[model samples]
Target: MIELNQVSAIQQQTQVFNQVSLKIGYNERVAILGPNGAGKSTLLKLINREIYPVERAGSYLKLFGNETVNLWALRSKIGFVSQDMQEDYTPYTSALDVVTSGFFGSMGTHAHLQPSDDQVALARTLMKQLCMDIDEQRMFQRLSTGQKRRLLLARARVHHPQALILDEPTSGLDMGASLGLLSLMRNFCGEGRAMIITTHHIDEIIPEIDRVILINQGQLIDDGPKNEILTSEKLSDLYQTSLQVSQNDGWYRCWHG
Candidate 1:
């Protein structure tokens, strides 16, 4: 469903992505594991066309086989969810209102934006599926971080996007809230939509995300089955730490002695 060949991202005359190549097939779930400054967020933006890739010979990005296409249409096909999406929302917007706005491709509900009864029903159904019980009247700014995240997921999936791209999904979430978010995503994985997740924490990765790609210093280090790519030495090197990684029943964790 996605392909990037010899892609590089340049910002302020500095390269944040260096000849990176990766492919994600339709309905394939994958996780991108990287440390700080590894350009994970940049990679997501590149896929969504939020930032243009460096235009050069032999470097190209193809979405559904076209190097050039309408970004607005591409956006509807892919649900790009991220921490940055939180900033676009108006502080006083209700959670339901926030979700309904996704249908119109707006950050939040607006004065002229009107949601149909069917769309409102769909949004509420998605909210319940994500186990979000926040009052429809509750201001978005008042909801907890996890609640906001769940509501956003509802917004993204309201249209059954072909793929979901999540960047640092659990960054500021506490243990309980993180688990809740993961659980929601875990269930969504089996519904046949693809997911590309970028995270520093290993445990946030769901087992259904059977493919793992590690990027460091803005380059693709490795890509393969999750079990093969995510290991003690690889992770330790990626993070530049003396760390030990452990896994149980396909769940991974990191520690240091």
Candidate 2:
């Protein structure tokens, strides 16, 4: 489980978050929603320890029930997929190589050793499951925007980490591909594994998600069951505009009036 205690972040003298606290448990699917510049991305960064929150004296953020662990040890258990893939990926690298590098769980490995056969096989399997059939040998820069996003997701799951944190996983995907990605996430739930996704679109919130965390101006407005907190009234307040929140066959849709 990942827990936060009065977690707040300050960057460049701006308070990205303030006294925020939340808990993510096993089999729990959480959605962090807010308008752009609402500190949604900053909150994810705080959880992964990518950047420390301001005045985080003690017990600000705890991962896997530990307050202290070696940096490398902590990253090994967390899988993160961010929208900014250009910086993390090698433009000329192969799709297979991109996924295999997830085992290293860092930007890029400096070693010259080739990945083992098992590693390569696992990468291919993940790609197939995500509906990514591009040639494994294709250069990373050659794929389209949506294809690149799917490849990054495969990369995150390559090592099979216990927790998956995705930022705008469906940013550039079409309807069919977006649904496929959500299905892939639904499979990740169970056996002490959890997935947290941050998305602005209501349609991207999969039905299997058990929890919803709504943020506005760096503050948590609501955090509870999807059905309970993701309603017309609550959503209206979050966006500060009238919205019609509806559900159809386990999918959510919200519209501005």
Candidate 3:
């Protein structure tokens, strides 16, 4: 559902992507894997229209078959959940208000932009599915890291978007919380929706995500099926170290040899 043709982007006066080209299809599960400052976040911003690529010959970016789209309309088609979003809400914002605000793409509910009863119900249902119903009236800043992440997940899915874009989704969680969030992501994709994940951890690349795109130092390193691209040799070279990679039950892991 996204097409980038020789696209290059710059952020903060630094080039983040150089002649990057790729395609992500509807209902596809893919991961943009890379280390810190590897342009992974920049690429996500490009897709989310938070940044623009440098214009040059034979370079273009398109989303959903069009070069330009209304941001409001696009939000309904692709839900984005990021760490920055979790930090953007006011400390006193209620958990329920955070989810319901998805309808207006706001950080929280305000008197002038309140969510309707149906929207509130939808948000509650999503929170319940994520096992976060108990935190409905709790203040946003009072919850633990995992709870905040799940609340953001509910916020993203409340609109029933066709696709979800998650950035570093499980960065700061205990093992149980991380796995729980990953499981929830898998269930979301099972409902005929697409998922595009950006992460540096191999464990976060769920089994349903068959495609893995490796990026390092603002350049595309590799793009192919998971089995082919996630080999010991490939990962070792990507991370610039001696590493051991293993797979079990379709899950892959890597560590120093």
Whose TM-score is greatest here? 3
Task: Score every model by TM-score.
Answer: 0.95, 0.91, 0.97
Q: Each model's C-alpha lDDT?
A: 0.87, 0.80, 0.91
Best by lDDT: 3
Candidate 2 ranges beyond 4 A from true positions: 56-59, 86-88, 190-192
Give the Å error, residue 214, model 3: 0.4
Which TM-score value belongs to model 3?
0.97
Cα lDDT tens digits, model 1, 1-257, are 88999998987788998788888898999999998888899999889888889888999999988899786678678887898888667888988998998888888777799999999999999988888866888999999888888888888887788888999999788999999888878878878889999999898998889999998889998899999988888888888888888889879988973
**Model 1 regions lying over 4 Å from their true place:** none
Query: By summed lDDT, which 10 consecutive residues of candidate 3 come out lowest?
Result: 83-92
Q: Please give the ranking of all candidate structures by TM-score, highest first, separated by commas.
A: 3, 1, 2
State how far residue 213 of model 3 sits from its true place (Å).
Answer: 0.3
**Model 3 pairs whose backbones collide:** 1-24
Better of 1 and 3 by TM-score: 3
RMSD values, in order shown? 1.4, 2.1, 1.0
Candidate 2, 37-74: lDDT as tens digits: 88888988887777886665654677778766566666
Better of 1 and 2 by lDDT: 1
TM-score of 2: 0.91
Query: Candidate 1 or 3, higher lDDT?
Result: 3
